[model samples]
Target chain A: MTLTATSPAPAPAPAGPAPDLAALAARHGLVESGARPCLPEYTRRLWGRRHFVTAFATARLTAQYSRARLGQLWQVMTPLLNATVYYFVFGVLLRTKEGVRDFVPFLVTGVFVWTFTSSTVLAGTRALTGNLGLVRALHFPRAALPVAYAVQQLQQLLFSMAALTVILCCCGQFPRPSWLLALPALGLQATFNTGLALVMARLASRTPDIAQLMPFALRTWMYVSGVMWSVSHAVRGDKMPHLVAVALEWNPAALYIDLTRFALIDSFAAGQLPPYAWAGAAGWALLAGVGGFVFFWQAEETYGRG
Target chain B: MADAYDARTPTVIADDVHITYRVHSGRTAREVHAVKGVTFVAHKGEAIGLIGSNGSGKSTLLKAVAGLIRPARGRVYTRGQPSLLGVNAALMNDLTGERNVVLGGLAMGMTRRQVRERYQRIVDFSGIDDKGDFSTLPMRTYSSGMAARLRFSIAAARSHDVLMIDEALATGDAAFQRRSKARIAELRATAGTVFLVSHHHRTVTETCDRALWLEAGTLRMDGPAADVVAAYEAHAKAKK
Candidate 1:
């Protein structure tokens, strides 16, 4: 698009030779408009707006339930209802609960943990498209939208965790030393979800049709992630190909679900949590978290532009 | 008045900037050249007016300077972040005006403490509470004029390096127009360069010392605001 600079034709006499305007602007420390900052500076700017990210997330979460009659109760009720429905379908009808111990606690924990990742991914898909007004109106880091959506989903999950704890207590599962492990496991899962959310944010921002197709993809992923049944038992019985079994074991969602179950359920913990499980969780978090952040940051300047 | 600002300190430099928009219809794409090699230099403390006929690329040029749009060719350079005023006022309608003030302040890069400090002043400046406790109500309930006033008040709260306004001042009551005009003067006294895009030539002639006139994607005139407006008006009369 480069062309010769055709100076505007005006009658005003120059004091002397017209100095190069571009050179003058450069000498004065002016930078190109709409240019993306370097990675380090971008990170610094995003870090500086941490409070904005949290405030925005909290505001959106509050607004999400404001119009409903039950208001914030839905945060817990939605997951509880989903868990009940899954139990009826898989545990009762299909009798998938036959080999599973503490089926109620197992199903509730899986639903709550899986909800965190699914909701986060869904929110990320709309982070930019849904808030086009804010995106076009403001000049902050675009990553703030997806990260804030991830935080909002995490907040919702925390509420669901309280309900899950009550259900576990009802199922006669008392707290043990292994329960302390749930914190780090959640931290790793949150990181993984945030990273994946960032990836979805960029993808959906470009092709918003991806947002429509995401629910189907997430449903398919949930079925294979072993949310309702035992992945280990099914694999041990040789019901699937070896490669498929290995993939189901290593799948990030299943790995996270297993990590939470190992932390919260005494019966699951007694079966011996594999050493590779923790390693795989950490590996997925690092891969998705760091990779997704840089991927999103690469297109920072193009977020709101047509 | 001309000597008040240091001419050597340039705040915005649009060097042969060309902005083009791609319009897609059915199965064809058309390229519309909005701003063709428009170049100008703006200095600190100058309130420059951008006056043009409809579809003359005045708003497009301002967006390019604000870094909202990238020039397809050439470049625009600025001393600091150039804020486009009214667009930032596009806040959440479901949110209360009080919450919108906080959100808008943070969106403009203000710290939470700064927003808290300026909260009362912003509300007071908008005169939103003159009749009742309107700031507590959702912004959707507000009249268009009131909403515009609040938006202008929020943006005017912060002194920016380069501020680009697009017909935001045309709304509001006469008393409010007077208050906002004074606020613009206050912003200029702080050495901020202001770019005002308005269809009202009289407003341009009154608020700005210099003006840029664009026609058919080219810079048609650049001089004193009154002179440019007069020239543009005469051209329009001749065209009719």
Candidate 2:
């Protein structure tokens, strides 16, 4: 086992004239390391990891508030506090709630639903960057990170929903058959948010500065999504340009918020939901869900690499 | 060295792999050619040690083999997904060690039931509870060595086709080191290829049958472990 020490060690001899190593590996059923699987295969792998996704999400959510004294209570309390601030600013100070009915219920529902999208998008921006250790150490679908973050936000939204329900009941908006409509509405929003999360995860993996910029972008998006004001009421008549009104109505964030609002609030549900509301919700979910997935998958092999 | 692994069946092949990292410093980007056209083939049941001085690209080459970093010029092929266990592969620090075990096991593609079955063994292997119930405490509360032990334990609980370890064994105490070496041997007995990168030349010679020595992002020596370690040590002494 001994060899004479040399300053520049000689290269090892080729193993039988190289012998087409790639072909040999292929013949032995080897696959290229880090190669992106085809879409169906990638989907299958991601589906296989569904349990991991949920567990990872739950772990993160539980650990999020571990340092705070109030702990998990903050999950519901955070959104309730946000609604309180928004209610004061818009309902009392600016009087923007003048035209809207059941202002508290509307505001609370909008806050809960909008928080789902905003937090999911924000989490997506950090998904790959934040979990680089996991990504580099383990071999799994990269989509799992963003998908798990979306699930985390959905869980947080559920906590906020419990609070939202109590607030709705206090405001005299008791449950009705229409409350079931919120289920499909939320299901669509969750899918849409998951897709958007996938897109953001891929983007932020490369340009991590996007994470620094995302909060401002999401805040601006929140304002336009009608979290604090009703898009339909603001767009009524010539108060805004027709195209601007149409764009606001069709905005994915506003569309989800509006769908949930229409389903949960008596005032909003009493008025006929525009015929296109469900169509728009389904459209955005499919577009973002499929498009964002494909977008994220295109860069699968490149996630942890520099 | 095991009858189960036929020496002819190669488990990993690196065909002229080159990896370059563009490190961003302020507004400018600089490209560091980390692994330059490195080529090698590892067979099943073999434990290979990667030996190099600091910044010699041993870790980079290991990462390339693990599929975490793509080669810029060539390709790496493996019989199955290669898992890399590194010092930096920290699990969630804020979560309890128990939760990390579960999460790490799942991340390695273990079924929930498998994780449940192996949970106690994994904790006992880590020795995190030898003093107290440290497994229930947050990982941040454990010492760095304890965390490394736990990480290694979780990764070792499942057999992998190819496992690349980077400086993980250097942190553990002697008893843990002995246990890990035994586990690595057991892994080889199951026909898995193992790649270890360590600064301790003796650990390499004792644990691996073969060695790959990289110098300045290029492979310098590839041979029997004792020979490569001897050559590398003599080279280091000569330079001093």
TM per candidate comes to 0.91, 0.93
Q: lDDT per residue, candidate 1, A1-306, as tens digits?
A: 221222386334344323476668777788777888888998899988887787778778777776789988988888888888988998899998997889989888988888899999999999888877677566778898899899988888888888888889989988888988889889999999999999999998777779989999999999998888888887776678989988888989988898999999988863534458999999999999999999999988777554
Number of the top-ranking candidate, with DockQ as the measure: 2
Regions more than 4 Å wrong, model 2:
A1-19, A270-272, B1-7, B86-90
List CA RMSD, all candidates.
4.6, 3.6
Q: Which stretches of model 1 miss by more than 4 angstroms? A: A1-19, A270-274, B1-7, B22-32, B87-90
Residue range B75-115, candidate 1, lDDT tens digits: 88898898877534346777788988987887788899999
lDDT of 1 at A167: 87
TM-score of chain B of each: 0.92, 0.91
